[model samples]
Target: MAVWDFAMPSPLHLCRAFHNSWASWTASEARLRIATSASDTTPLPAEAIHAPPLPPPVDTVYCSTDAGFSGPDRSPTFGFYVRSMDGAFVAAASGPLACPYDPLLAEAMAIHEALSWLQEHNYHNVQILSDCAVLVASFRDAGSYRSYLGIVLDSCLRLINSFPACSVKFVRRGSNLVAHALAKHVSAVEARTVWRDSLPPFISPAMI
Candidate 1:
């Protein structure tokens, strides 16, 4: 049987053991720091994101126009309404055409009437909206007219040029309900009628 003796380690062996232990502890600490940094930088879920804000509303008035034609012999009537930027009714006008009856001509005349009315009221900055797409397109393209209605278009262009700021736009029929209602209500009229700071009872419901 061989006898086993327990002995204390030499200083050199102790120093080597201490160095190895310190290196192992430092490596473990560095790994922990890296893991913590990666967790902190993780991306958030899609639902946690936020969207940018919308821009503010524009500062401008809106005027909508429409025309109603009953028959070839009957005169066509037009209606127009001006609203503030916030859509509060500013003024309204409706009347029968003094010119010969034609649907396209009636639409152009309607716009002319509205522009003339605004010009008379000293409204420089104005935006004209119509349910008639062709009329709006003609005005946008600044086309010259040669037909019987050429004079009427020229008059409308002159009125538009008088304004310091003016624009013509085409809108959906549903959006021009008030103007349509006014046109239909005044189809029997033989003269021009205007309402300022007040709306007619017939178009009151449609204003909503």
Candidate 2:
């Protein structure tokens, strides 16, 4: 039998106490491995757990329709701008016409043209930002448009659905300056223009 002194125990005494308790519980190899791992910043080779991949980031295209209204006798002109995902200049289109159409209808038609171009040019997986909440909501609802709006709405819906997938959102009018400026230009004149590859000098800086 070993006689142990408790009141005057030294450092060796405490070490022996810990060893007696843990020596039988853990294998000597495990203890050595734990010590080696604790001193190293790199973990053990087999300890790493694999993680699943994440989804790709979303892309957005901001578009706005501006219906330029003149006096009672004139037909309102329509213009639109499509900005790239990072707000860079993409393209713009505008036209002047005399039709007994409401602003909502004109907005819908402008969106229709933009989407048509997108489909024709093979742009897929996009979110559309607009300033016409009602027009967007109408597209989402799909079945509640008024009877007189049937032709244009149907054409627009078909064009929209033909995409890989597109989302419609409304933004502030102030944020839609490029399209509004184009609409103002079309309203004051009697011409139509479709811009691609580059934008006119005046509207280029703001778009970028």
Candidate 3:
């Protein structure tokens, strides 16, 4: 009969095999985490996060008005531009006031002139925008007025009441660029100009 010998794997070899398996799994896990971290830290585009919200749609015509005053004692100029809800220009007017007035009075005069123009054109549903916050506040308050400004404010209130549907709102100067430009132009000119269906080339770029 022949003798047979049996041998088992050494403890050290078993431990080495286990260690290799564990190390491979740990490396794979680390790589996955690094990929995840890279994706998580990526930056987003500026416009995606910082863009301004668009204005809501409207059913009524909108007009932007502004006034330019050279000084408290100098003649003021008024400018206004009317457009449809979809941004189609309807009319524009700019002229120097017959008398010199303070800033507040000038703004009130501009608002009054714009409302009168709208009434003349039979525009009932109108939304007026101005960059003067005080004027808007006064309209909202319907409070008492004093001095020359008081008379102008009273006229503005009366004109506002005539409209079947009218709204006055405050907007930033940037959004009132067209009207501001028109006011500036009128301040430099001696005659009053009215554009019923078109805008001057200088003010066209500011529209819409």
Q: Tell me, by lDDT, which candidate is best.
A: 3
Q: State the C-alpha lDDT per candidate.
A: 0.79, 0.69, 0.82
Give the deviation of candidate 1 from the true structure as CA RMSD: 16.4
Error of 2 at 68 (Å): 2.1
| Pairs of residues at least 3 apart in sequence or in different chains that clash in candidate 2 | none
User: What is the C-alpha lDDT profile of model 3 across 1-208, one tens digit per residue?
Assistant: 2233666667797789889999999999999999999989978899979988965446578999998865444668889988898888889889887546577778888898899999988888889999999989987555576577778777888888898888799999989999988888834347688897688778766355
Better of 2 and 3 by lDDT: 3
Model 1, position 115, has a per-residue lDDT of 90
RMSD of 3: 14.6
* Pairs with steric clashes in candidate 3: none
Candidates' TM-scores?
0.66, 0.62, 0.67
Residue-level lDDT for 85 in candidate 3 = 87
Off by over 4 Å in 1: 1-59, 140-144, 204-207
lDDT of 2 by residue, 106-192 (tens): 777667667776777787755565677787778766566666566677887777677666767788877777777777673334677
- How many pairs of residues collide in each model? 0, 0, 0
Off by over 4 Å in 3: 1-59, 70-73, 186-188, 204-207
